[model samples]
Target chain A: MANLTTKIGNLTLKNPVITASGTFGYGEEYLDFLDINQLGGICVKGTTLHRREGNPYPRMAETPSGMLNAVGLQNKGVDYFINTIYPRLKVFETAFIVNVSGSTLEDYIETAEKINSLSSIPAIELNISCPNVKQGGMAFGVDKDMAAEVVKEVRKVYHKTLIVKLSPNVTDIISIAEAVEHEGADAVSLINTLLGMAIDAETQKPLLSTITGGLSGPCVKPIALRMVWQVAHAVKIPVVGMGGISNARDAIEFFLAGATAIEVGTANFIDPAVSLQVIQGIDDYLQRHHCESIIDIIGALKTA
Target chain B: MKKFIGNLVVSENIPLKNNHFLLKLTQAEPLPLMLPGQFVQLKIDDTPSVFLRRTFSINYVDRLKNEIWLLIQVVGDGTRSLSKNKTGDSLNLIYPLGNSFSMPTATQSRLLLIGGGVGVAPLLFLGAILAEKGFSPSFLIGARNVDGLIELEEFQKFGNVYVTTEDGSAGEIGFVTNHSILKNTFDKIYTCGPTPMMQAVTQFAENKSIDSEVSLENKMACGIGACLCCVTQTHQGNQCVCTDGPVFNTKELVWQI
Candidate 1:
């Protein structure tokens, strides 16, 4: 039987299919549909130092074959997650990666420090690249210096696998990925939602209350794959790819493009059972190809 | 984890002229404990091109007869397809999702139920719960016009019902807050509907220093709250409405934010 197990950085996952942050609130929400312990890892919702109230109403707008959202890193701060959610998540057998976000440098360090001390957490995905918010979200991610500086500061506090999540809203995503890697990000995941907008022709107004929102789902797969491939070639660290990955074939594409692990984001909106489907698909593909393990396809793409 | 739980077909698909439909599903299983203000995500395969499930609040549930009712507004392609479902066609459903309205306390003597637009379904269910517990509530329901008002003959058995239509063809012509019944003090207030309408009720309750709980209407994914798709701003911080609430106390909400 083909083995689906894979390792990204210091963490060993049963498979490379990890649920992206914001998409999977925590692992427990999908427990009824599937075993949370069965998959690779669960990246919890973005947590901040102080709880943020998020943005105004009409936070989400549906685009053709995709969705745009401005959820604004809305989370119950790090302390609340550690207090109310972490203990419950400890029961899941898979690795738990905490996705942390903050408006300031100190907030990032403090939140990272808090999660670093937790025994249940295996890694931290610093979400400095969220495109849906007006505050510190894409602000730190768009700039190479700010992105590296944020990663550098968190690197001091977080001893676990530091996976820097990169935003796709920049001019050149590879430069940002290199900057974070230069500052010591063990791994990187791209691309968080892409910046998008929708308009209500009748009202002559923007569909989302935020005017602009982060687009996800099938609409972002091509762009995300391109960035993943670019960053993988540019950086020495492991690259975890995500963006519009709804099916196993999508995951395989990322694997070929050079992502060590894959994350399912907006597809969660399509099917809560999607992650399981992707896992099975990978297994089937591997078996049919006579591959013993997933490592064979990690970066098999040939260069011209 | 999904079994062919049950298939519900369209029994009655009546359009309320308010862009909403009062759909009665015929084929359903024995419902588990469903509370007021809870919802069901429906799989309406009326047409082959349609994809994704449309969510509607459980307007009422008849557990004994094994029937479920939904008050759905034909807003998008999904709902348009649902409206076309014939009586014999089947529909897949995952239901009684999100947090229900807080049940009235035993010592509480009065229950005030507020509803706006399609948000009245759960309130009717709430009224049924109050009736079962022998607590009669005063219900204030709102809509844009007479076309928006849903027939409430069945609800009369559960509570005192009042209707507010923007066009004045019904019980009260003005807004729900303009009704005399809501002007008085009550032990508890429950509401669901348009955000602006709920915000108004919450503001009114705040002025009187009365306790009220509002059910939010936000886009959701995994209706169980995992998607973080249905998030709301609260006094504490950003919280998933699907998890932390679909029901929240009025006073506790940081509405201005």
Candidate 2:
């Protein structure tokens, strides 16, 4: 059998098939569909220092082969998780890496510091790339200095693995990746939804309440793959690639392009058990290729 | 125990009045326990234009025969595409996704169920369950015209059915709110339909001091509450229509009553 275990920073994932932040919903939502402990990890919804109501209704709309969402990270605050949700999730066998986001440098550090105390949570996917919120997140993610500054500050109070998630709506993603790597980031994940918009021509209005929302799913796969291939080669730290990873074949392309692990996003809404299928499919591909482990295929893409 | 994702084989696709279709689906195993007023997230296959899963109320479930029914209205590309599904085609969906209607506390409590447009989908099941429990319930259905009326026979099986059409082509000859039956005393009311109609029903219930619940429909993605797209404001806060409810008590909703 092919070994499927992969590592992001020092945290060892059972497999490379983790659920994306907003897509997975604390891993409890999929309990009816699949076993939550089987995945490599699950990034629960984005948590901030305070509760967010998020955007108004019509926060999401379906584009061609993709979807746009402006959920704005509506969470009940990190304390709520630590109080009510964490007790339930702490016993899970898989890695419960919290995705922390905020509107200020203080918010990020404070949120990260709070998560640092949770023993069961192995890491925090620092979300400096949320495009939906009005402030902070995407602003920092698109800039190298701001990204590095936030990571460096959070690194002081946060003792666990610090994985910085990057935004794709930028001029030079490589600089941002290297900057975070320079600031002691354990690993980097890209590309957070591409910024896009959709309009209802019949109604003569924008489809989303926010007008512009994050574009994700298979439509953004090729662009995400290219960015991952570039950053995986450019940075020394591990790359956790995830844009439109719905199946194992799409996941394999990320591994070949040089992702140490991957996260499944919007596809979870379509099929609750997709991550499990992805894990099984990856193992099947490895056995078919006679590869002993996943490391053999990492960054092994052939280019003439 | 709550919900399951399954591929249901299309057993029958019965076209109804208007641009609606009654889709009967079954699987190899017995259908999961689904409550009346709960919904399903249907996955559209081979349709390039429709990318997201569409949400529908659990129109009816046949336990003995192991079948589920969906009342879909062809309002857009997604519904039109789903209407094209033929018998034996596999349709994947996540069922029993949201909360169900809470039954009345007192036995023989006067109950009225109002459904409009395709929102009438779930009331048939709710009325059937209420009748099974020995409660005498009444149904007031509204439509734009006679063509908009659907499944009158099915609803008649469980309750006294009342209807109104805007064009006066059906019962009462006006909106459902204009029906003469609203004068009668009732303990509680359950309604699902166009927002304006539901709002009117709620106001009437509030004025009568009768408890009422209304099911809301909104633009949704990931009908499991993770996406947070399908939300409605309430006294507590903004709640996801997909999870917290597609059914909410009239008093809890922020809409003016």
Candidate 3:
């Protein structure tokens, strides 16, 4: 059997498959769909210091092969999750990562500190690249200076492995990846939803209540793959890639592109069991290729 | 694998006098255990342009034969596409989402059911429950015109049916609150529909100090509270409609309209 176990920075994952933040919510959402403990890990919904109401109506719109959303990091705040959600997640058998977001550098550090105190949550994915919220998230992610500052600040208080998620909306994504890498980030995840929109032609207005939202799904696979390959080569830390990856073929491509781990997004909206399928697909692919360990193919892309 | 258990096609998609339509979904799932005001997310496949599921309150659920009915209006491309689903076609559905209206408990007897526009869906089911329990209920259905009303005849058995239209094309002209039926107080009042209509009912209930519960319609994703899109202000603070409630006590809701 191929060894799927791998390390992201200082942390070790039993497998290379993970569910993207925001898309997977808490692992409980998929309990009826599949056994969450059987997978590598699940990145929970983005959490903050306080509860958020999110955006207004028509916050989501579907594009050509993807869907756009401006959910604005609506969560019950960290205190609620620690008190309410954390205990339940502890028993899931596998270590689960919590995806954290914030409105300011201080806000980011505060959330990281709070999460670090918990025992069950093994790591944190800094979602510095969400395009929907009005404040600190994508703002910090887009600029190399702020991204480094936020990561450095959070790193000081957070003892857990930190996976800084990068945004695709930037002009040069590799530069941002370098900044976070310099700030002591343990790993990096890329290609949060791309900024996109839809319009009601008859009304001559944007279809979404927010006018523009983040796009995800099969349409973004090619661009996301290119960015992941670029970042994987740019940073020494492992890169967790996600975008329009809906199946096993997509996951394997990311692994070959140098991604240490892959997150499955958008496909959760289509079918909740997609993460399980991706895991199974990777297992099947490994058997077919006669690979002994998944590490053998991590970044094994051949150059022409 | 979350296979498509059933693919219901649009059987009859006729525009009601109001912008809403009376849709008959073919290949629909045997109706699940849905109470009134509970809704289903319809994957309207008529157009490739809109892929997000459009949610509709389950107007009726017949579990024995396993069929569900929805009253949808052509509000947008997604909804417009829903109006195009016809007989023999498959429509993907995620059912019985959102919390249902609280059925009348031991303390309540007389139930006042109010509905506006396509909001009457769950109220009918509520009315049916009331009838089965031997409680006589009064129903007030509000629409833009008389033609907007659906399943009115079926409701006659549940209670005294009252209709209100904005253009004066039905039983009573003006808004649903314009009907004299609302003037009378009952043990408990239940409603669903446009914000203005529910707001008016809430106001009337508050003024009368009558305990009333209203089912709100908010745009949602994940319909299971995973996405915090469908939240409403309440005296207790903000609550997700998908989990906390699609149904809320009128007194608890912070009504804008």
Query: What's the ranking of the predictions by TM-score, best on top?
Result: 2, 3, 1
Q: Candidate 1 — which pairs collide? A: none
Score candidate 2 by DockQ: 0.83
Q: Write the per-residue lDDT of candidate 3 for residues A223-285, one digit (tens) a residue.
A: 999999999999899999888998999999999999999998777766667788888889889
Q: Return the candidate ranking by lDDT, descending.
A: 2, 1, 3
What are the candidates' C-alpha RMSDs?
Answer: 3.5, 1.3, 3.4
TM per model?
Answer: 0.88, 0.98, 0.89
Residue range A1-304, candidate 1, lDDT tens digits: 5788877778889899999998877877776667777889989889999886677767877776678888788777888999998888888798899888888889899999999999989899999888776678789999999999999999988898999999999999989999998899999999899889999999999978789989888878999999999999999999999988989999999999999999998777556777989999999998888889999998888777
The CA lDDT at B106 in model 2 is 61
lDDT of each: 0.82, 0.92, 0.81
Which model, 2 or 3, shows the larger DockQ?
A: 2
Tell me the lDDT of model 1 at B187.
84
Candidate 2 C-alpha lDDT tens digits along A158-230: 9989999999999999999999999999999998999999999989999888999999999999999999999
Which ten residues in a row are the worst by lDDT in model 1 chain A? A265-274
True contacts kept of each: 0.33, 0.84, 0.28
